[model samples]
Target: MPTQGLEKSYSREHIARQVQRLGEEISRDYAGEELLVVCVLKGAFLFFADLVRAISLPVNVDFVRVASYGPHTQTTGLVEFRKDLEMSVTGRHVLIIDDILDSGFTLEALYQKLAGRKPESLKTCVLLDKRQARQTAFEADYVGISFDSGFVVGYGLDYQESFRSLADIYLFDPAQSV
Candidate 1:
């Protein structure tokens, strides 16, 4: 896809710094404990990978995929589970990692689902938190960045399955696309 309509939001260095800070914080919080890092795909894949590596703890990684925005910029208020975690979360210190906390539907739904599994402790982390767009009352325990508005793409965020491989994040304006 062309990058004609994209405006840089966050540089790769900035994102890395934030991720490292989060990792350190997480490591400190869960010191002497094992962590189950559950990644929300496919947006969180890159963030998840970097986060786990930065975290200095014994962490087991798993992935779950949910679809709320099939091919749209905004959510449809429906969350469908495409994949589930293979590892059990019971009695584990679990952390849910996601790309963005938009409408709160996807993260909240996934959080509730995992909470029902009865983990010893459950918390959430998001690369980006857009409080203005929230449709449900939900908040992430850890947030990498905050934005008032804009559909972002890059650093694993995407639009129509593109721009995810970009090194930095950008405000995507579809109307300006070539």
Candidate 2:
């Protein structure tokens, strides 16, 4: 349990196991389909790298850079694209991989943008689902774990651009965040 300082809740091995299971599920579901993995970059980078290799089927990986947080501790409810995908995404099976689903604003916004491209199917996968007041109706097709906590900073999640390198998932101090 996290308290004063950042503390581990799940180890790296545990995360790897969960990701392997997710890969199996994806392989089973989309066996013969055209699969394109859209990795939301910065945080999702680490998990995306691990997950794709675990899948037994052929898949293509693309990346999109989105930003909502500035120097603050919470989301600004706004998504700005730092980078976009190169693929057309027209009539192809698209799988969006995000590091976490916090308030859902960023993911929802991304989903809407991707929807405009008209894919054959759009599925979202998340590493962590932070139990908060999410404003979107969009649900994650694949979820690693759920947690009710303050801002976490590990396993690609961070605070003020730090702590993303930790292999374990951890909760940062509530008082330390803005």
Candidate 3:
């Protein structure tokens, strides 16, 4: 695998701290309300697990699998719904958790689909936001980190289905490695 250009971006400790803070904020904002925590599958599996454990509020968990990138560094701009939620979001406070906000197409598509179901309120949370790569105007309600560029892997994020188990985030440049 081309792991030569991998460079550490966010340490595991740093990610844990940020996730804890985000959880506290979420728990405070939704004080007395129950949350339908939806995890965008595959990439968000790890972040979703940690985030839900951090929040103190009552949470119901569900999973949806969507794909825009298939073993590629850039998005294909077409969001494919691989798996649908098993529970209904009608009149419920729904929060979508994703690994990263890059081109925004995948998140936006998912958001719109859920919105059509008439949730009482809908929000988004992403572990990382790459503002410069946005092809749509979608913005996450909660964001852990923001950066302008570079492909990142690890801590639930992956490149070609690899590096997701790494303890920290890393900048990976495929062109510079073999």
Candidate 4:
């Protein structure tokens, strides 16, 4: 790990405060509607856990695993569903939670797929948005941080399935590429 490639981007406290704000926003907006918290698995596990708990209202939680990045840092723009949601999202306010929105492929594809299900409402929530890495067209409905695009890892983001244990987000050095 090259210390030079690393940059302190989001601290744990900063991330938490933003999450709290996001929760409050949701609390106010969907005051009466029943909510479904859909956690995109793997990367979103940590963020999802924190977010659902921070929320003040009752929420139905479910985990769905999807894959677009396979053995690569860059996305192929193909989204695949490895696991589907176990709960019914037929007619409820659903929130799609994700860790980072790097390329538009995953989220956009998901939105399209879920849209066909006819949910009462569908919205997105991302912890970090690499607003620059987008190639296709997609945007997060609620974003915690708008960060410069970079190979960032930590919090819930990982590199080669490593560094998921770091409490804060750190940048990745391109020089470390194999």
Candidate 5:
């Protein structure tokens, strides 16, 4: 695997600190309100778990599996729901948690679909925002960090469904990729 030469980017402490900050921000913003955290599954699971723990407020959690990219490097541009949320978001404060915001198509499609469900309020949060790769009109309400376009793995992000168990994030060397 090209990841044999995986170069560490973000450290575990850095991630924890940012996650705490995001939790505090989210907790303050949603004070005294019923919070429903929608985890954009597979990738955001680890981040979602840590984030919710940092939040002091009571919040419900749900998972939704939406995919725009398969095993390839680029997005297919076609979003599909592999798994849908079981709970009704109606009248609830909804926060969608995603691992990364790349092209914005998946997030935009999800926002529109969730908006149609009549949630009292809907917001988006992302662990990493690659602003340069955006191909659609969208923005994250809360962002943990931002970086230039690069393949990252660890702390919930993955490359071909591996390297997710690493303690910190690593930038994959494209030149090393086969």
Candidate 6:
């Protein structure tokens, strides 16, 4: 592990089960419709791949890169769109996937931007939901897990762009930061 005092919160099996359940739910809800899955890049890439594979329907995938957190533990509060979706989502069922929902600022901003594109319906799916850190009035339509608060890394999440490759999700103990 890159960081000491880290504790495993969610095992790889647990995450797989959750992803399967979510995929089933999505497939059931949008059985007759085509899905355009938009993945928030870098962090959500791993989760996005697994999730799309789980879905029973054929899905079109696109990636958008946004940054609100820099080389620190907290959000910078300024969201920057490093990249945008390549395909148009208009008149399509669009699903936005992210690794985590932290302060909601980044997701909220992205939602508004995509919503303005006039997708037939837009929904958000997040692997981790840190509700305690939410600063905006935005919520994911499909959430895998809801955690209180911690700097978590694994399964596509990172710490200063590290630890994302871990199979299990681990919580970074702030007291151990040096």
Scored by lDDT, model 6 comes in at 0.92
Give stretches of model 4 more than 4 Å off. 1-5
Per-residue CA lDDT of candidate 1, range 1-178, in tens?
5566689999999999999999999999999999999999999999999999999989999999998998989999999999999999999999999999989999999999999999999999999999799999999999999989989999898889999999899999877776
Q: Model 1 clash pairs? A: none
Q: Which ten residues in a row are the worst by lDDT in model 2? A: 1-10
Which portions of model 3 miss their true places by more than 4 Å? Answer: 1-4
Better of 1 and 5 by lDDT: 1
lDDT, each prediction: 0.94, 0.86, 0.94, 0.85, 0.91, 0.92
**Which lDDT value does model 6 have at 45?**
91
Better of 1 and 4 by TM-score: 1
**Candidate of highest TM-score:** 1
Q: Can you give the TM-score per candidate against the true fold?
A: 0.98, 0.92, 0.96, 0.93, 0.95, 0.96
Per-residue CA lDDT of model 3 for 33-121, tens digit only, reads: 99999999899999999999999999999999999998799999989999999999999999999999999999999999999999999
Model 1's alpha-carbon lDDT is 0.94
Kindly list the per-residue Cα lDDT of model 5 for residues 1-178, writing each as its tens digit.
3347888889999989989999999999999998999999899999999999998899999999999989877899999989999999999999999999999999999999999999999999998999889999799999998998888888888878888888799998656866
- For model 2, how does the per-residue alpha-carbon lDDT over 19-106 read when each residue is reduced to its tens digit? 9999999999999876999999899999999999987888989999998987777889888999999988999999999999888889
Instruction: Give the Å error, residue 152, model 2.
Output: 1.0
lDDT string for model 6 (23-117, tens) is 99999999988899999989999899999999999799999999999887789899999999999999999999999998999999999999999
Q: Which lDDT tens digits does candidate 4 get at residues 1-178?
A: 3334568788899989998999998888889778999999789888888888888898999888888888678887778999998888889899999998988889888888888999999999999999789887799898888887788888888877876777788887657655
Give stretches of model 1 more than 4 Å off.
none
